[model samples]
Target: MRPGLTIGEFATVTHLSVRTLRRYHESGLLEPAWTDDFTGYRYYTAEQIPTAQVIHRLRQLDVPLAEVETVLSADDPRRREEVISGHLRRLEAELDRTRAAVVSLQRLLHPDPADLAVELRSVPTRTVAAVKGVVKQDDSLSWYDAAMAELDAAFPADERTGAPGGRYDNELFTHGAGMFTVFRPVRRPRATGRVEVLDLPGVDLAVTVHAGRHDDIDVTYGRLGTWVVTHALAVDGPIHETYLVGPRDTPDAAEWRTEIGWPVFRLATGTPERAAADRRR
Candidate 1:
């Protein structure tokens, strides 16, 4: 019988815990080269050390066990690389989320009043090319991407009259699913595929510019809502957002500027206290 290193000896050489080795075996990720019939002791060959190291590295990166198995089981080098690259991309996205969360937390702790600013403006009626769909709150970003891409491709820069904008139904925020509409003011509206020409009615709006990433956009919305309730009565309408500068304009997220607009009416004959009370009801 060709003798191999015991689990303990293998763990020592691989710098992996014996418990981890056992877990890897139980998960069918890395099985031992031999097992004693009487004692049931597990042993691994020196040749398997590199495989163990690879598994260890993947685990260190917090790759799911199933994905690790897929990566290791793949016979083609390109297939293995594709699997690993996919996981790495996911890790990069997670890192971005974490960084955004940290920045948001810092802002919450500091509580800067100057970060928020609200204004009132009257928008003129315009004919636009738009895409509308029912989208889940979680899927809003990707839906926006697809909708905006369609709009951009349908109308060239010369045809575009103004910045691209979106209108989100209140149900989206209140019920987690609702209609999302993206529009672009065109020199002349033309229907193409999912894009359709439509006239947007004008309305007075309480507007605010939300600068940078949307990770904490809810804070800006809260501030705008407060301003609307205090100075004006919020009317029945979807929330509007004009993308003054966006991903299509600049790759740098810090340079992005979005104008948030809440439709409203001037509060008629009431103190701020009464308006606040009425809004609460």
Candidate 2:
């Protein structure tokens, strides 16, 4: 007998089988402390019991064999900590995605059709203090910030406000790069630098309030477009998004509200009654 247990005794202590212990030995995962030359038997020392327990626990946690080997072989505490921390970060990211999916599903189940607040109204001609520039699609967000800053710096929004407006060119939507504008109400039209003050002629718009982050707001646009089509309206102007509350005003992404406006005209050739009938079908 060695100083401690035989393979069978060690397996009993660890709640593992003799066959599993042998396999572990064969795989060089947990080698025996000593080998009997005469009898060709395996013997493990008392000290090896704790090492076996660690391997068992790690396996239960579903850690890969290679990773387990690396962790076990690493003597440095910092290196092991780094490996565990990396896995934790990945798990946290997955948890966030799972939570977002849950929120989306809940909204689908108890959907409030009215919760998507939409209003159709006519906006009259107005002079707006504006900033316009050519912007790439990838740079749209930055351009929006710069344009808003310029507007605020020029003629900040006050109690006396007209329609907050934006005009994006077709290329901005189709080819992903073109002109953009941000404007607030002004008394007179004029031009300053790339910023051009202009009159926004009267038009009807289907406006919807999106009460959440900018991400996934496209779903709201889709809903509003369907509403317009069913109401016998044809989209005639560039899509405009006016920021009601932004990240700068409230750091919480949950509280962000943006108003999406799509300009439309009465479908010239179509009758509202016919459109309503088609919508029913």
Candidate 3:
């Protein structure tokens, strides 16, 4: 009943539920300036109103409870601003990533069919420097990151030195399997570490160029699969992906092109047993 307000009064002023204010009090993020021992009631002074407003603002910013506590406890306004600004920067970066993913999804759902860019290519035997590893589709990101790191460490900066790429089997894509790969470009050979250099003999393959965010690359795969089937061809070997341009080289998604190849053979109006036996030699 003094000039100060009770917990309920403070809650009304703050526009926060009494329960939430009580939680903040229990969490030590906010505390009453005074308490009535016999009544077990909490009381707050006018000075405490600013603290309540700050808690509301920080919560609105999605700041973590621990971080909010740090900002609240800091005596210097500059220090508090620094902490909030740092958090805002991180949130902005996350927003950008989310926006990119959304755009990529939209492109996937509604792709330009008129630009049905496809080609029949005959790939020849060649050498490639690579790192090899077996990885599940879900963990492909980690696997690829490790491979690229190793390749980058092995090779110096140069023009002929292109982005890291891989070849994965249809089984891996269609029915999640341990993805295997050689990270760098090297000459064709019989064996090389877990990564073996083998010649991919010249075979006419239906090729398609998928351009955009890697997050939605699956759309290209699905479309290309239909292309192969419609043409009466069955996948013969592993799916090979050549990165003509990469994020490291450019931030523009439209400029990124992934050459997808489904090693195929002419289907004779029936289910064709996998022609090229899966092997690493």
Candidate 4:
């Protein structure tokens, strides 16, 4: 009945606006099958309907125009699938952050002092096999992985005395960079490559277990910090994080448990009875 589908007709069929199709053509994302030399009107083919629909779905997922073009122009199906899969992974990480934010907001709106159970402990001096570095906050995660891997290789199951832990200095959070030490408690700590035998000093700590993924670990830190300050306990040393049950031990994030130890000293101004009441509450 007609020579070809006009721009308006193609847009209506694809559920895309006339302006959007025009933009796509201008950007070389989705060019029309034909153009009239006389009137300069654009025309598309019935076969292009699928391509338009695919582009629509990709755009809906917030894929960048360049990435969408890469996906569309990919010759191999596997290559196209890889591009989509990468985008999906990014979306999943964003969803995790959003969920963590929602949980933090709910806790903030409805404060529960008892949500985090704090325990005070006096730890003795100990020796450990550790890798030390001065790293920025952004690089800390990757550095941690490499350091932990080295420690694990050094001490097999038979030699390990305790779970792997990391000691982070206050300047790490205050100045965006600081000394970080990741260590493994072992029966016989030794020096190997960057891993060295270090003597860790004794200290009093107010500790708490942060459950689940670390996406919202900052909320737990906040809660712990609040408790330490209100109970007349002053932070005294670098923060310690012991990976009791971590990703290396289990694939389930829900089962992961991290012990956050805040080094502190008790001020004599506080009443023991009041502190006991606070703990019981």
Candidate 5:
């Protein structure tokens, strides 16, 4: 109608729907060059076409409308690139998670028949430097990484005595939040930052090693649980995970070995009754 293009013509040129363009205008993400006062009609100059195209590209990536505005408003090319790159990194991380989920789902649909090897052992008490805290289930891995790094920094290579291990409360898995304690044996225990010296009491446990990536570690846990239910009875104690060979030891995931320990009591006498009672408890 005017010297510039109408909303419909702009949408056709940009390959964006009229509804989407209207939304962008209302959200202040993109504005028409001019609007008629009496008719309330919108008009966009040819110069605004590039802006519409840029908005279209960003929206295709599912970038937030506000972020799109920020990107468009950025004067420096590097600053605009940095903003887009940050979103790309997040998308990449999401892609990785999606791939992992696909693999897990495939394994669930077609499970491996091989049985896990489990052993019962008695552990002795020991003094160690440890860090303890409450962590959400989703944040557990990142928190563990940070805590372990702190412990490693506290004790040098020579002072470190043995492999690192962690104790996890059942509530973490059941209720999505619980206490987590990670400890490593040291030649001489001392407090540093969040780390402190503490004595861990001896306990009997049913243990199984989960090899390779943690992607299918749940399968191993299920097998270990089945073995415990049939041969022994689980007692009240935190689950212990000893990093026999972990990420620090090897870059290859196949070489990783984590010993999963479930505190247990032998079911030699009154097996059925005690087992049922324990289950009830």
Candidate 6:
């Protein structure tokens, strides 16, 4: 038997097509061990089979050609592993996002629309330890985790007065990027890292609780918005979200509760006194 396998034989041995081997050779990804000078025929040695299999596996994972090249050419084994690990991390994150989307779609398709219960709460001015970020909507979730982690490290559980909350600016929804503030209601709030003491102004809020995870929280927001429009005018302010029970409280998402608040003034016959009198009834 000949020492050099023809391209077709190599393709058969590696479960790769002849056309793919030629393309790989053309891209300088997998050059043949030997080439005929006159006929321009390509041949591979048995030693290249393991490399061919590795490249095929990487490609099967949908790894980018550039990254696959990096893994192949990297001198250090650790560097090759780093490229593979990074891609795996990205795949995991994408899987989580896909799972969340599937759950949301299922809920929407077979919805059990229940009447939303809203409460009018008169909030008082309070000082809290907070972390703020100016970020795009796409990055809000990651930024929230980082900022909330910072807040968590600074304040012990015993020091917290109430559930953690966040304020979101309108520009985040309308203009793609805006300011976000995450705060923990703490006794003797102080500045640490990104965390700062913020004096939150008092306002009346029409609040409703959203059950379960945030994947379908938008539906609750829609219902609350409709309730606000019918009952009272929406006052211009950042929207508030209170995580009454979350991952920190319980691993079970079914037990999670989030309070959404829209700042508002009571509707009445056009005067502060009239609104005050109506509230007294």
Best by TM-score: 4
Q: What is the lDDT of candidate 2?
A: 0.73
Can you write out model 4's per-residue Cα lDDT over 1-281, one digit (the tens) per residue? 66699999999999999999998999899999999999999999999999999999999999999999999999999999999999999999899879989888877788765757888877789999999999999889999999998988888999998999999999999999999999999999999989999999987788999998887789889989988887756555899999999999999999999999998774232453465455455
List residue ranges in candidate 1 displaced over 4 A: 1-9, 35-42, 89-97, 266-281
List model 6 lDDT by residue over 13-95, tens digit each. Answer: 99999998998898888999989898999989999999999999988888999998999999999999999999989888898
- TM-scores across all candidates? 0.84, 0.54, 0.66, 0.85, 0.75, 0.80
lDDT of 2 by residue, 1-281 (tens): 34558888999999988998887788778899888899878889888888898778766666677776777788998997777667667777677767766766666576665745666667677777788878898898788888767666666445226545577776897899988877877655566665676766777677898888765565676678887776766555777777777775789988887888877664333554664456455
Candidate 3 error regions (>4 Å): 1-19, 23-29, 36-42, 45-101, 113-115, 159-163, 186-203, 266-281
Better of 1 and 6 by lDDT: 1
Clashing pairs in 5: none
The per-residue C-alpha lDDT of model 5 at residue 91 equals 89
User: In model 2, how many backbone clashes occur?
Assistant: 0
In order, candidate lDDTs are 0.89, 0.73, 0.72, 0.89, 0.87, 0.88
- Shift in Å, residue 224, candidate 3: 1.6
Worst 10 residues of 5 by lDDT: 266-275
Q: Rate residue 87 of model 3 by lDDT.
A: 93
Per-residue lDDT of candidate 3, residues 1-281 (tens digit): 58478899999998877898899999999888887888979888888888899899889889999999989889999999999999999999788778867877887778776856667666666566666655688778677777766666555565234555677765666677755674555432233334455444455567887787676677777788887776656556878788888775688977888888777673222332332222211
lDDT of 1 by residue, 1-281 (tens): 65899999999999999999999999999999999899999989999999999999999999999999999899999999999999999999999889878877877787785745666677888889999999999899999999999999999999998999999999999999999999999888989899998888888787899899887777778778977766647888999999999989999999999999999764333344565467667
Question: Candidate 2 — worst ten consecutive residues by lDDT sum?
Answer: 266-275
Better of 3 and 5 by TM-score: 5
Distance from true position, residue 142, model 4, in Å? 1.5
Segments of candidate 4 deviating more than 4 angstroms: 37-41, 70-92, 112-115, 266-281
* Model 6 segments more than 4 A misplaced: 4-9, 36-41, 230-232, 251-254, 267-281
